[model samples]
Structures are given as C-alpha cells and as structure tokens.
Target: MTPSAIILIVLGLAAIGYVLGRQRALKTAQREGVKLHSLSGYHGQSVALFIAVPALFLLAAWLFLQPVLIESSVSGRIPQSAIPEGGARSLVMFDVRRIAEGLNQIVAGGDVSENDLADMRADVTDVRARLAEVGVALGSDVSPIVLQTAKEYRATDLTASFVRNIAVLVVALGFGAWALARIRPGLRARNISETFIKALLMGSSLVAILTTVGIVGSLLFESISFFNMYPAKEFFLSTTWNPQFRGGSELGILPLLWGTLYVSFVALALAVPLGLMIAIYLAEYAGSRLRSYAKPAIEVLAGIPTIVYGLFALITVGPFLRDWIAQPLGLGSSSSSVMTAGLVMGIMLIPFISSLSDDIINSVPQAMRDGSYGLGATKSETIKQVILPAALPGIVGAFLLAASRAIGETMIVVMGAGASAQLDLNPFEAMTTITVKIVSQLTGDTEFASPETLVAFALGLTLFVFTLGLNILALYIVRKYREQYE
Candidate 1:
C-alpha cells in the first residue's frame, strides 16, 4: 500500500478508538454513580492522541531517512570508474534515481510485465530506446552498471516502504488499545490534552526559529567561501562594480549600496507624505461609507504583482519621465533611471504604509481626542498632537517596513532602472540596485569556484544585514513607544 493510504488507514482506526474511549468513560462514571472528572470529549481526545501521534512521528522519520539510506546503498554498488570526468558521484546517483522512477512508470503502465522486467538485460533489450518510448530522455546510451544499480534502487525502496507501513499500523493499534484500557473516570485526560497542545505549539515555534538559523548559516557559509577567494576589504571598499568571469574582476558593494540607498530615498520622499496623509484622511476625517470603498480600492494596489508594476514603469513612466522631464531639463535622458524605479516602487509601497498607519491611528483612544476637544483644540490640531504621538511607534514601523521593501525590490529596479552600477547622485542617470546586480551576476552557465559567481553570496549577506537592522530598529521603536503609552 502507498504510505499516504497507510496513514489514512491508521487515522481511521484512531477515530474509531476515540468513539469507544468516550463511551467507556461515560459508562464507568454511570457504573460508579459519580460525577465525571472531565468532559467525555477530553477522554476520547487523549486516546486519539496516543494512537496517532507516535505512529505519525514514525511515518515522518521513515520518509525522511528512506531516501538517504537508499542513495547510500545504491551508490555503493556502482564502480568508482563509472563516474564521468568533471562529474560528481552524486550526479551519477541522480541519473540512477530518475531512471529507476521512469522504469517504475513503464512497469505500472503494463508496457513491461513484471516477469519480463525481472529477466531484463540492458544489452539485449535496448534499454535506452525502450526508456525513450516511455518518455524518459537520456543524454547517452544507458550503461550496464547504471541499469543494474537502478533496478536495485527501485526494489530496495519498495521493500522499505512495505516494512514502514506494517510498523506504523502495529504501533498505532497497540498504543490505541493500551490507552483505551487506561481510560478510567478519574483519568486526567484534560491535563494530557493541554500538555499535548503546548508541545505542539513549541514545536511550531522552533520550526520558525530553525528556518531563520538555517538561512543565515547557508549565507554565512557561502559568503566565507567567497571571501576566501576574494579579499573581503576590497569587496566592501572598492567603488567600482565590474564582474569578469575570466579572472581579477573588480567586485565592490559600494556602487550597488549607493544606488539602493539613492533609489530608496527617492521612494520614501514620494511615498511617506502621500501615504501618511491618505491614512490620516481615512482614519480621522472620512465617514464609514467613504472609507469602506476607498480603503479596499487603495489596498488593491498591494495585490497587483511587482512584475506588472515593472511593466508599467518600463512602458509608461520611464518614457514619460525621460522625454518630458529629463531631456527638457538637460539632465540624463535614459528612460530607465533611479527616478523611474523609485517613483514606481513608491507607488507600490503606498498601500503598505497607508493600511498600517490607518490601523494604528484607529487604535488611538477616543478619550484622548475628546480630551483635546475639551481643551478647545481643533480636529486637525488634536490629530497632530494627541493622535499622532500615540500612533508614532506603529507609524515608524510602517515606514521602515516600506523602506525594507524598497531596498529589496528587484523587478522594478531591473526593468525601470537600467542595470548600471553607479555612485552618481543624479536621479535621471541610469543605475541598478543590489538585488538587480545579484541577479545579473548569478545568471547563465557558470562555475561556483570563481569570485565572479561566489561574490553574489557576499552581496546577499550584506543586504540581509542591512534589512535585518532596519526591522530590528523598527520593532524596538514600536515596543518602546507602546510601553511609554501603557
């Protein structure tokens, strides 16, 4: 049976056990002529947890370990000479897995009978041509060693899956019966359920923490490799950004960082005031009817994909800015410029700031506004003095969030702002951000041994630090102000 089907069967038995456990609890209480200690459902839930949790954990562990064990067992069977020049042993194993899976597909379709497959030989059956008929493409003729190893891989995996199914079912049923036998009226089923829930919550929290740690560790590892190949000081200090795959390429973060900051600054310059005012008008002045229609309309901008925004900037805004403003003013006449991407990105960020600030402003107490009115302050004055101060922490967080988004933007910067790394301050001049440069450096057929390719990781790590700092500062400000208000 399939692993998924086996899991479903185990769960079905557990569900039956729950019903029996609940009935048993009720019967024991009635027979003893006493009130139950806890609800009948808790007793049933305890039985279900005992039945399902251990078995499900086993299933998960089996699934995780099965591939590793199969790879180890199968790869050891092939001769070391089977690996081609400039290729890894793992690459040969990859082909083994693909071929094994493809052969299974053919057998399942009845194109190859079980008896024929058991007696098959690559030399006699023309294995490559047969595999092709089954839609499995191979680069070259299948070798005898590879075919034999693939057949073993398929058989071993099948046997292991069968064993796993039996083991899981046995554990599920065994623990389920034991739990049912232990279900007395005085059993602390409620406490058991609560403990189970708490452990599940902790496991979920750890998954998130582990995910962050894993990301940082990968970046740090690759960045270290990059630094070993290229000097760390020059990577950070040199002003030019030229990457030559041949060798001795001038790779520096300064120009990309400058362009990123410059574009972000222009974005914030346009976004902050407009988004803030929109939030203010929606939260403070607009009626419920107007806000209902307007808020969703504005939020619709956030739903539109960034690629669409890039297209808008490339076709509409870039040309409009270059022809009318840049050329007319004798500034740089490039259609793709810092100004074009910044303006488009700012428009994209408007909904984020406006939505967040609106919520923060609405959270301010009515009593504070009333107190300001009692002091003969006008509505605008009350909003500025009483409401804004209270919402300042959340507002600052909103702005920082927008800034992170702008710094990390790729599509708009790639298409709207041309891919030239420059430290110039002129907004009309073409420039590229850290993200765009990362894409450019990593694209196409390349070897990871070169500094040209590895430098992308160094660039990524630096960008990660900058955005992480922005988020941390934003959170700190929000917490400090919240504590002060409370």
Candidate 2:
C-alpha cells in the first residue's frame, strides 16, 4: 500500500474511534446519572490522539529506516569491481536505486509482466531502452549484476512497504479499540489530550533545532575533509582565487572575501541612509493617505525577485554606468562590475530597510514624543533625540538583516558583477564574491572527494561563521545601548 493510502486509512480509524468514544462517554454519563470528569469532546480527542499519533510515528520511522536497511543489504551484493575507477560505491548504489524505480515503473505501465521481468537478464534484453520507454533515462548501460541487485532491491522494498502498511493499520486499530473501551465518566480525557498536544508542540520545536544542527554538522564534516586535502593557511591567508580542475589550484579565499565586503559595503552605504530617511519621512511626516500609497509602492521592490533585479542590472544599470560614468571618467570599460551589482543590490535592499525601520519607529511610544515636546523641543529635535534613539536597536537589526541579504545575494552578483575573482579596489572593475565561486565550483559534473568540489562546503561554513559573527555583534550593540535608552 502507498504511504498516502496508509495515512488515509489511519485517519478513518481515528475518526471512527472519536465518534465511538464520544458516544460511549455520553451514554456512560447518562446511565450513571453522574457528572463526567471531562467533556465528550475531550474524550473524542483523546481517542483520536491515541489512534493517530503512535501509528503515524511508526509509519514515519519505518519509511525513514527501510531505505537504509534495503540499501545496506543490496549494496553488499555489489562487488568492488562494479564500482568504476574513481567512482564511489554510493554512486553505484544510486544507479541501482534508479534502475529499481524504473523497473517498478515499467511493471506498473503494463508493458512488461512481473514474471518476465524476474526472468529477464540485462544481456538478453535492452534494459535501458525498456526503462526509457517508461521515461526513465539511465546514465549508462546497466550491467547484469547491477540489474540483478536492482531486482532484489525492488522485491525487498515492496515486501517492506506491505509490512509497513499492515503494521501501521494494526497499531491504529488496536490502540483505537483500547481507547474506546477505556471511555467512562471518570476518565481524565482532557488531561491526556492536553499532554499529547504539549508533546507534539515540543517535538516540532526540537525538529527545528535538530535541523539547524544537522546543517552545521554536515558543513563542518565536509569542510574538515576539504582542509585535510588543501592547506588551511593558503585557503584563508593567500590573496588569490583560482580553481583548476586538473590540480594544483590556488584556492585562496582572500580575494573572494574582499570582493564580497566591497560590494556589500557599497550596497549598505547606498541603502541605509536612503532607506532610513524614507522611513523617517513616512513614519514622522507623511500624511496618512500618502503613507498608505507610498509605503506599499516602495515595498513592491522587496517583492521583486533578485533575478529580475539582476536582469535589470545586466540590461539597464550596468550599461548606463559603464557608458556614462566609467567611460567618461576613464575608470573602466566593463559593464559587469562591482559598482553595477552593488547599486542594483542596494536598490533591492531599500524596501527591506524602509519597511522595518518604519515599523520600528512607529513602535516608539507617543508619550515619549509628547514629553520631548513639553520639554520645549521642536518636532524635528524630538524625533532626532527621542524617537530615533528609542528605535535604534531595531534599526540596527534591520541594517544587519539587509547587510546579510546583500552578502548572500547570488543572482545580482552573477549578472551585474562578472565572475572574475580579484582584490581590486576599483568599483568599476569586474569582481566576484564567495557565493558566486561556491556555485561555480559545485556546478557540472563534480567529485565530492576532490578538494575542488569540497571547497564549496568550506566556503559555506565560512559564510555561516561570518553571518553568526554579525548577529553576535548586533546583539552586543543592542544590549550595550538598550539599558541607557530604557
């Protein structure tokens, strides 16, 4: 049975349990002529939770574990010779799994009978061609041994799926019947239901925490592997950014880091002041009608995708900067440069800063403004001295968020700033950031074992650490000044 079908069946059982449990509780209360410990709805909810939660948990665990067990069993049968030179066993298993899925598709399509599929050999039949007929394209021709292993894998997976469906249904039905039987006037059904809900909420929070840990853990492990193959000192300290797939590449990160900072610095310098001023006007001076229309109009830029901004940079802004400013001043000739990307990204960041700062400024108490006014300060002075200081922490937060967005931006950098990693100080010169290099390094056919590909993870880890540091600094600034303001 399919997972969706199993879920539907479990839900049906839970619904039935709820109805029966509620009826039983009501009947018991009427017959005994006593007040029920919990309401009929709570009894129903308790029954539903008992029926659904454990069964769903079991189903999720089974689905996750089945692949690991099946792969372990099937991959053991694959000989070392079957793994191509310079290829890992995992890649071979990947092909085996794909072949298995393709075979299943063929059987489901009714082009091939199960008996015939079991008897067929890779040598006797064009397995790849058959799979292709069902829209499963293989990278290479399948070997006989690999084909046999895939068949076994399919058989094992089907059996496991069948068992999983049966086990889940049985658990759901058994628990549901047990809960229904326990329904009575004295049962603390509300307590049980509430406890289960609390547990579910806690589980959701843990899932989020674990997900973050998993991402960081994966990056750290791969980065360690990359550092083992490449010198850490050269990667961190040297001022070159070149990667040769053939070998002996100078994978220094300094140039990429410099470009990232330079572009982000330009973007933030453009965005922060304009955005803050816009926010101040909207929050402090603009009439209601003007604020309503203008705020949304300005915010529409935030809704625009970064790729669209990149295209705008490439087609419009880049050329204009090159021809009007760079050519006239003899700065540089290239359309794709750090200045082009930074200006476009800065434009993209405007709405983010303005909207956030506007909200933060408006959140300041009106009494503070009144107090400043009563103290004989003018409107502008009150805003500058009272409102702005009160809103500074949140404004700093908005700036940090915008800075992070600018740093991580890829499409704008790719289209506006050409992918030439260098440490040039000129904004008109073509340059690239770590994000662009990470994408380039991982693009196309890649071997994860090589330093060239693994370097992407190292770059990712470095970016993560840099962003973390920014967050920490923002927190420190907020805490240090927040007391004085309060």
Tell me the tens digit of each residue's lDDT in model 1 across 48-106. 98888889989988998999998998899889889899988888999898889888988
Model 2 TM-score relative to the real fold = 0.94
For residues 1-486, write the lDDT of model 2, one tens digit per residue: 789999998998889888988999999999999999999999999999999999999999999999999999889999988889988889999989999999999888887899999998999999999898888899999999899989999999999999999999899988898999988899999999999999999999999999999999999999999999999999999898888868888999999999999899999999999999999999999999999999999999999999999999999999999999999999999999999999999999999899989998987888999999999999899989999988998899889988888888899999999999999989999999999989998993656678999999999999989888787876776566456546
Against the hidden reference, what TM-scores do the models get?
0.93, 0.94
Task: Specify the poorest-scoring 10-residue window by lDDT in model 2.
Answer: 477-486
Give me the displacement of residue 305 in model 2, in angstroms: 0.3
Q: What local lDDT score does residue 426 receive in model 2, on the 0 to 100 scale?
A: 92
True lDDT of residue 226, candidate 1: 94
Residue 422 lDDT (model 2): 95
Q: Point to the candidate with the largest lDDT.
A: 2
Minimal lDDT window, size 10, model 1 = 477-486
- Predicted structure with the largest TM-score when compared to the true one: 2
